[model samples]
Target: MTAALFLTSCSRKIIPGKPVLSSTRFTTDSLPLSEIDVPLRINLKPLYETANKNVQTIYGSPGWPNDFEVVNCDTRYMYRFKRGPLMITAHANTVNFNFTGSYIIAGAQRICTGTGSNRIPITPWTPTCTCGLNEGERRVNIGFKALLTLKDNYDVSAKLQRLEPRPLDKCTVCFWRQDITSTVMDQLKVQLDDTGNEISDSLNRLNLRSPFQQLWDMLNTSIPMFGMGYLQINPEKLRLSTLYAQNDTLNISVGISARPRISLTKTVGYRTVVPDISDFNQRKGFSIFVDAVMDYDSLSQLLTRELYHKRVDMDKTGKYIIIERCEIYGAGNEKLIIKIEFSGPDKGTMYLTGRPYFNRGKNQVEIKDIDYDIHTRDLLIKTAKWLFNRRIINTLNHYSTFNIAAYADTLLSKVNVQLNRQWQKSVSTAGAVNNLQVMAIYPLTENLVLRCNIRGELTVRIDAFDF
Candidate 1:
């Protein structure tokens, strides 16, 4: 009876030794993958208007004066004239001036007195007389054109280069009352040139420190707050790429190079100079590899909830087995090792080993070719009738899949929603998930690391100036 029992337990006819697990493996890692590209568009009208307002505030007061003197001279006589109190009024498209002042004529005076000094009556003579004249208001309009350029410096500030003034119209009083409007106009031209120079100086000295500081604050404090689940962008640098003019708008392109990380704190600051990106080729899209780590504790909880203590019928003889505990570990070379302990009619432990790969079409991570470990298979073969259950192996194979693609899609949706909510008024972002695949799977100290390649396109629209 003992010999018969041994034969029955070791019989090949009773339990199959090798179970073929049909699955596919991808060997090519050089497949061309798409990338995520972010394009930003900015409008320049608001910046232009704001600059105009700033210029007006500095020079538009009524007390400021542009003083000039004109000499009315002829072969017979010469008279010195002075004009003062020139006020400036600035508009968006032009600057207007009003000069209304008392002009004093000096250098020649009449010496004839009213026939009373010392009873000596001098002949009443109309000598060359120096007189004070009140010149009425003179209005002049100076038109200008504004140009913008990206200045090369440590901070890379924006410069407004004001071109030469195109005088729209000018009117000046005739100081000599002898058709000398040309001479008076000449003096006014000199004064207008000085005023124009002042305007140019103000414009050239405009500092963009506040705007850039606000941008840094938004990027570091406001935008990253929506990275649900610790996802964030660690910006290493921001570089100016290109600046140009299109129609009435100024177009600027800035290149941002950053890394995506999982963080819980806000850490960033403003930098004047960024890394050299001159050789960084601008692409419409780019791809990134992200490591989504599942710690042992979380994996343990998930597996417990899904599979622990589950029972499976093993054979038709009313024998069944229950899983007492389950555990997962990373095997090198993109594989997972799952160890499961069984209870019920028999009590034993088994190990499952298989390679995990990304199913691009389904957007999920599936374990393929799962089978019993060598030691577990040997143990099962040794005690086939008492301890081995084929249903347990089938059950483990059926449930050994991770839905990574769905998780990625859900993550993308959450990020997009947050971006829209945060930047709806000033900026807009648009993108969608294109492809996701597993690149590698490795073991960390206490976690299973999964690296995946994600590809998509992101477009950013920035309203630089509000209407």
Candidate 2:
């Protein structure tokens, strides 16, 4: 009960002229630049160690004049103060340091006789001391705060908020309790100021250009996609978000403007130098628009394997044709043309054209509005009217779809390889692609192009940066 069984007479060979589609160029529209955000976590332990190494632990010496103070008729003191290791912490943009140490003071009550113009010491300076000469030392606490800011040129500026010192024990002189902590702290101000300046200078000299430049160059390089093609990130402008400190780490987000594309052949693009840091913008995640171009030859093969020698029984009226071969190519006007050759009641070739659209629900590229070529339609209307059945069109529509999920998964793997790797000796990146979906499809002369959107998150880490 096939269509070919009912044919009584031999039908004339139907050879229709191939459709001459208008020559139309396929051009990709200029889309807005995509943003790729990468979070950066810089370790601050090395910086703290550098600061601790450079800051002096010992302040005043026990000798006089240089590290001693004398108040006429009050007291004369000489002290030696030693500080413990620095304990550093940070929050927001400020770094705080606390140092606890012990101090020893040796002094005596002094009596000055005579007028202000002619003051004289009446007694020799034999002094009884507290926490000196084989005695325990008095403990003290030293605290400092540094407010950090970053410049456009990648310079770090640290402003000293304040330096405070408090002594745990008070000295008693001449049977009266006396507090000499203020005098000791005042005497140590100059040394504390010098230490603060040293730390700030060291912080200012830290350079980030080397690491950033390496990252920029890596982004500009081409990455190969297995069995597909090459992908270029094509990064442009770069910006950074506000800085935050967590424990001993500095956290920030670095964003770049990029236009990603896929090509069959490797392409080398112009490399630009890393520019100055831009204003801070608060944003998360990354969004990239990718133009994934595929060759027509590959597409033709894929379609041919599914449709070749496929028998289509149109209406079961003995008017059926077996699909011999098929080829897919662009038909201009943003359309795809599938040329099908068959044999049954008539032996000839026919062309079906349709517009390709992305089916988001199914994650596929499906063809719609499929119909015969003008010449094929005319020839079929006269010789083989059974070919005009809607079942043929429906069958073609069912099998014409291209599953995009597999292709998207391949692309995601390729991209993630580049996103997560070590770019330099001290810099490394980690990223993951959460989603990649086809937004549009275009049939071009040489390639079938898919415009896809990819979403992901990336992080860059610098293990060691010179302080």
Candidate 3:
């Protein structure tokens, strides 16, 4: 059967004190995202490949220029010839940049354009036939750097800040027998500036909207299972912060504000957000409070299996006590009422009450302040002392103390095993539970509730599309 689950934090050390019984009620309060450091890496290989493909498709047409042009100053004439196709190359370095630094370079080659004319006339009276031509194209190297900034509009934009000119590669060309070398160099410089501007504009349009939207949808659904149960984080909204380039990879810290729920069944649908996105606090580290329910029927079955039909002897006069069955229920005021039926000369039911505490060192939830119910104690002392004996009281106390602890440990161990196993995988996220302690335990109408606080780290690897 499926059970309801809630979330809370863990205490660093176990508190040494006696359990106090009170009539106070408890409820879960809204929690903020833990102020913890989560590092996310983004690969640039795919981005480079996309850019190269787009450049080739857009510029590799039959009508596009494939050469450079040179012009004559005296005749105002231009000469053009075939050279090679314009090309763009991209290189990414993820290991050289700091967390806040930005320096990415892209190179363009064979970029030039000009009008052409012929100075020779066919006849003395005829004017020279003029036609445009481009030639002597070579690689003009340039450097470009941009800063990736996250805007409040939930988009990422690359701002080009610097462009540095580098020496051009050697080129083989036929000259027009004129002093036009300086003019040609100046024209090439202009081409480099124009080309660099176009590239920067294209890069600025790159945003992480699509990929992150997919990730948000995935997280809103069921996550990896923990034992038979799965964790579901129903996020109210997403918040982005601290985006910078580090070691060649883009590091983005995402803060998710969610009212997450956990369930054992798979039939539950998606949870909707009730609070506004502005209500979320943007911080680091992680803390969760969980309200775990223990059903009375399940507790009864477990106790009966462990203690039923087992006899405890008080004296050698055949005065032995045999447990028939056990039942547990809530007493409404932070108390668990346990009823035990015995088969002996006394042959009656007895009641006990207690408070619960989480033992961090032992990793157990022990029922403390255990004592006989006021009415039961008087009856056992006055009428059933011979058959029930005082030893039965001690035996009942011991059973209640350790049984709950064993149950809590078993549940926690299963969760820890699943989390640890995920951590060992190459492309999976894992969580470590530290300082887990019980905050409070109260009896509900249907089930006993144990509120707990757990503090820990959640590490997610971004490689191989792991979220």
Positional deviation of residue 181's Cα in model 1 after best superposition, in angstroms: 6.9
RMSD per candidate (Å) reads: 10.3, 7.1, 11.6
After superposition, which runs of candidate 3 have C-alpha atoms over 4 Å from their true positions? 1-36, 56-137, 165-167, 170-202, 209-239, 257-285, 313-321, 341-351, 359-363, 369-390, 403-427, 464-467
lDDT of each: 0.48, 0.76, 0.49
lDDT of 1: 0.48
lDDT of 2 by residue, 1-467 (tens): 11111234575455677777777766667755889888888888888898888878777754642555766545577677777998999998888988887776667665668876577878766556554345467677778888887777777778875467777765444312566567666766666676667767766676666567767877787777675688888887888777788779888788888888887778786577888887678677899898888777777787778888888888877778888888888855688888888887667677788888889998998888999877778777766788877877887888888897887787788778867887677778888998987877888777788888889899989877664
Which pairs of residues have clashing backbones in candidate 2? 2-318, 3-318, 3-319, 4-318
List the candidates ranked by TM-score, beginning with the highest.
2, 3, 1
Q: Write the per-residue lDDT of candidate 3 for residues 1-467, one digit (tens) a residue.
A: 11112222321111112222355564334443333333445555445544444332122112224322222312222333221232323223211110111111111222223434533323222122222223323333444555556555544466553344433433322322333334444544454444445545655566665445544564567654555355555666566554655443565556665555444444354534332223223355556565555667876776787788978888656777689898877644667777777765446566777766566666555667777776565555555555435566666666754344554455556665655443322234566656546666656646765565656665454443311
> How does candidate 3 fare on TM-score?
0.63
- The model with the greatest lDDT is 2
Clashes of each: 4, 4, 24
In model 3, state the lDDT of residue 272: 43
Q: Please identify model 2 stretches exceeding 4 Å from their true place.
A: 1-21, 36-38, 54-83, 101-133, 136-139, 168-181, 207-211, 223-232, 262-271, 308-333, 337-354, 368-398, 409-435, 456-461
Best by TM-score: 2
